[model samples]
Target chain A: MSTLRTLGSAAGAAAVVGGLVLVATPATAADTATVSVLHGIPNTPVDVYANGERLIDDFQPGTLTDALTLPAGAYDLAIFPADAPDGSGEPLLEADDVAVPAGANATVVAHLEEDGSPTLTPFVNDASPVAAGQARVTVRHTAAAPAVDVRAGGTPVVEGLTNPDEATLTVPASTITADVTLAGTDTVAIGPADLTLAEGTSTIVYAWGNGEAGYDLAVQTISGMHSMPAGVPGGSAGLADDTSSLPMVAALSVAGLAVAGAGVARVARNRG
Target chain B: MRPAAASAVLGLALAVGAPTAWALTRPEPAAGIPVEQALPAPAAPAGAGDLPALPTVTARDAAPAAAVAAPAPARISVPAWGVDAPVDAVGIAADGQMELPDDVSRVGWYRFGPAPGADGSAVLAGHVDDREQGTGALYPLKDAAVGDEVTVTDAAGTATRWRVVSRQVITKQALPLDRLFARDGAPRLTLITCGGPFLPEFRSYRDNVVVVAEPVP
Candidate 1:
């Protein structure tokens, strides 16, 4: 089940390259949805074919594709080995009629199932703005591991999350230590790592790799979804009452006096 | 301190003594166009079979969930304020300001934010007063007390109830924009309108009355 033990660091390097792609292409049309591709099969470099077109060549494992904004539609996807000649051999994995919704931000991950079979999973990224002082955390179980319980601060936050499944929760923005254990058992499987949940953002943690070889974790962030009133800032200072504030009352009195004085001046001028 | 005093003294000199300027304005709700038109087109209906089955989760747990997609608000009602108004979806204008509802009797739901019952704070704004119609639908929010029930009905007729948790009047400059517009958190609703003394000079109200409510139960 653990075929690509040596390719772990290479996958991390590919992710860095993917991050650069994301920074370079920041213009997405309003009507389109942003779709990113993640190659999770360890130790394998492959070419990705979408709708019969070779979209990515020599795509390394543990790497991500820059988000592509495409019109909402169905596209056939196929994964071919890196050395396989284009259009010549059988695909390593394929999914037909993969649907991409309009205006949704999503990640399609090609990873191994718990049984060590390769599969594709499409996850819709929640782009909804988080409330002030809050963040969203999502845990995706994509490794070849048993059903697991995800704990935050030593308590189970998500339980019975098996491979290719995910659980999400909204939490106060803070740094938390999280660990994964086998479902209903305290035996730790991965992590005592610090997870930073920043305000108005979604932090997605993926558990990858086989448990026997020690599972690995990857983090991805999608930000800028913060819910605030249209025009108000979150840190606004508010007035206690309308009429009683000393400054307000004083200002009103001054204005009243000014208007009265203006009236007197106009009357005097008329009499003159 | 001197600058602050100076500004106050100057304010008196320039005070025109006009009626308080109500900040809320009832612009004609985008002129006969459908309010939902301003929002992103609804995503394509997802096919049931497209999603893979969870390894050990039961069929019931696998059923498509309500939280997957937020439904657009169709109406809003505040029982304590005697407000029962149709909701008009409003988006940000070309000037980057939120568009106001055209109908003085209706409330404008910020379409860019989460829907009323979604995870984030859904915001609804209305005019305090209209030139011809007098008080706007949300004008009574000034008196909204804690525990008042605010119900939002989605297009699918699912009604979610919220209870007022806090209410305050804040100057426009001090308004918490992000909190009012947040799209993720414990589901909440924010009601806002013009408040405080109207400034005729600026032709707008000086403060905003904000009512924050959390989901019931």
Candidate 2:
């Protein structure tokens, strides 16, 4: 595979192939949904189909697809092992009657069930506006291990997170040291890595894999959804007005001269 | 000492007590801006879980990341208007609006938005005029015409050029915030300043002078 993976949309965020970067465009129109796919079952590389059409080819574990804009509705989804002939075979995972709401940002993942069986789970991503200098971070558990607590700076930010469930937090934008510990215990399960939460973005982190196979994280980012300024008070004086009279212009030149004189005097004082 | 020198100069200008023009366009270094607030504790956790075990991430654990990072903009200029100004990063102000620098000579880039050369609208705002000073760095923006060229230089000294495509005088209430501050779209440059009749009672301009520029590929 080439080192560079290109997202379909020109406006879409860039996606990192085998690591942790996936930027998405939020769905804002009322009739379409923005959706992405994450292949998270360890060592299981598969092809994904939606409504009998091939959507993702050779989708590998720990990788996330770019956001797809689809009309709001229900669709059948099927997954086949990589290189399966034209979606004709027994499927590894199937989800029927999956409903996608209009103007929603969502991600569907093929991950491990708590008992170690593979399953398909759909999650609606948060698309609400964030304040300036703030970011939204969402954590999803898709592994087959027991519940765990998510910690930032050694303190629990999320408690008792189980498989296929997710938690979200809106916090100031900064690089944070994060780790996952067994629920109510100090046993480190994952992390202690520094995650850069950029301002005005939603960063979704997925914990996927089974205890037997080992676990890993994949990150998806959604940009845009920053609050507008109350107002831009850019002009305090009316001098920029185009309709100023001749006298106003003359006075302005006088003021300019006075300012220039003041500047000269200040320079002289500095020399002294 | 700098403050005293500035006040003395300002005092002389005020003593003149004459009508002011939009001069003082030289870009000066931004000063007295407050430090950004520290990141607070994460907001309350929301949503439910399905399954999970912890995952350890390290430099050795994954493939090398190849994502592109845009440099921060340091200055902006327009040859058409003879305008040059320092760029300062600003976040939300105390009133929840985009913040602007106290000095009119420097332009404030909306730090939360996409940076220039990124695939989204990169917004920069500057004062059109100030009460203490005469004209602002962006005071000439109201007269901008289509085809004018704008150049933004990043901290790394890379300069990106843009061509003015449109200029509008929209009432503050009617400003289209969605397009002006869009997060996903073809990369563009958006410049803003106050315009229209100045309301002495409210001490503000009634409208915003918005200039949209497309990247010069």
lDDT of 2 at A255: 71
Ten-residue region with minimum lDDT total, candidate 2 chain A = A1-10
TM-score, chain A, per candidate?
Answer: 0.72, 0.74
Is model 2 an incorrect, acceptable, medium or high docking prediction? incorrect
Residues B1-217 of candidate 1: C-alpha lDDT, one tens digit per residue: 3443445445555453322321122111112222122122323433334332211111111111122335789899877778899998876544445667867688888765678767666788877775556667877766776678889998999998988777777678876675566555567787877776665455567777777777899
The deviation in Å at residue A256 for candidate 2 is 29
Model 1, range A132-164, lDDT digits (tens) per residue?
A: 556899998888878999999999999999777
Misplaced by over 4 Å in model 1 are: A1-30, A211-213, A229-272, B1-217
True contacts kept of each: 0.08, 0.34
Best by TM-score: 2
Give the distance in Å from residue B182's predicted Cα in candidate 2 to where it truly belongs. 3.5
| Candidate 1 CAPRI level | incorrect
